[model samples]
Target: SSDVVAGYLDAKWNWSTLVGKVNSSTWKAHSVLSTTDATKNNLVGVFYNPTTTTKGNKVFLLAGSLGELNRSGVQRKRENLGLKLVVGDVREPTGSEPSGRIDWAEPTSPLNESTKTAHQGNLTEFLAAGGSGVLTEDGTLVFPLMAENGNGDVYSMMIYSTDNGSNWALSEYMTFAKCYNPRITEWEGSLLMIVDCENGQRVYESRDKGRTWTEAFGKLLGVWAKPRLVFWDVSLHLD
Candidate 1:
């Protein structure tokens, strides 16, 4: 609540972000939130919704780490559009952590060490930031999934929940064999998933909104470490 840099874009694409805050307790004013604190999770997206009661108006804070699903206490208000919101904060009521911040101006999205360990299994304990999440035009919140077995074998799978974060199930094994940390983007009416391994950078394309994926190989499909995908200005780019 105290450290937030918020911005808004009007109909003209003119934008502005908050640069200062007044500390209520001491009434001391300070500059904007530190850049180091905000970009830790490695992703920031405006989970767009075009088919909801809100007429697809922006949903608050749908852009955090992948453990977002396990944050039980944070309230998600996008069930009307099948997107879940997750928030993390210090559990101690008297602790220094800011109140479970829900600033539309600046959403609180932290990848946390959760206390509710029942549903998380080992997934919560490890590096849970699998990939950038996507909200489909059909209103499904799909996360690039990484599933690990008791035998310590890790497999890539896709997970989605139509009812926000209330229920989730594996969509399918990724189109490639033995890959993890899949980055996905939607372009030209297709879902493009990219990942890299010892073999090379593998490209997977899904035309049916993630139900099925096909291997789309390219010249640069190999000779790289793990790769990530991003979409901007009607183009899909790899990073």
Candidate 2:
């Protein structure tokens, strides 16, 4: 039997069921698990297994908007922060008894360095944004980030850390189609990038391990739709 929390409120159960029903309405959004603030206050995050393993195991990264609020009903203060990684184990349930617990890295402060700062500038001016990082079959981590300069433009680059952010290096500067969302995934044993360009989706593949990229697909679709692609079990899955 599944372990039920003591004194569970009926309203909580009802609300949970309602949210699940609404989420099931779309298949694309269904594959990816996401969390959003109830007020739709621009606080949202997502998690998924890019490479669907037989055991359905995966890792999750989160990003959200942070800032103070002024009384004008406008976002007078805001900054986007990268999602902290939560390491955990998840397994299929055999009999509804909590199958396993996913362990995640405790939330920690962003790495700060004079030359390689985390957010790039004042928290209020930066938009915390990131995507599923490139994870190699042999186990490697390559994360990409875009710094919103509070202007209409965004600065694109990758953060390479051999020792995992304790020490870091920056990639040559790249520009996106627009200052929208950016994501990274592994395909054909290479790292590929997907970004929102002029309200359209652009795909770029890096053969030399994220050093240089070549356009693979351009204007594939509109930005209103979630744009993501990954190789799962030798097949391509896109959303």
Task: In candidate 1, list every pair of residues with a backbone clash.
Answer: 200-222, 201-221
The regions of model 2 sitting more than 4 angstroms off are 1-60, 70-76, 79-83, 89-97, 115-131, 150-152, 160-170, 177-179, 217-239
Native-referenced Cα lDDT, model 2: 0.44
Per-model TM against the reference: 0.45, 0.51
RMSD in angstroms between candidate 1 and the native structure over all alpha carbons: 13.6
For residues 9-32, could you state the per-residue lDDT of candidate 2 as single tens digits?
123448776566456643122122
In terms of lDDT, the best-performing candidate is 2
Question: What local lDDT does model 1 show for residue 78?
Answer: 23
lDDT of 1: 0.42
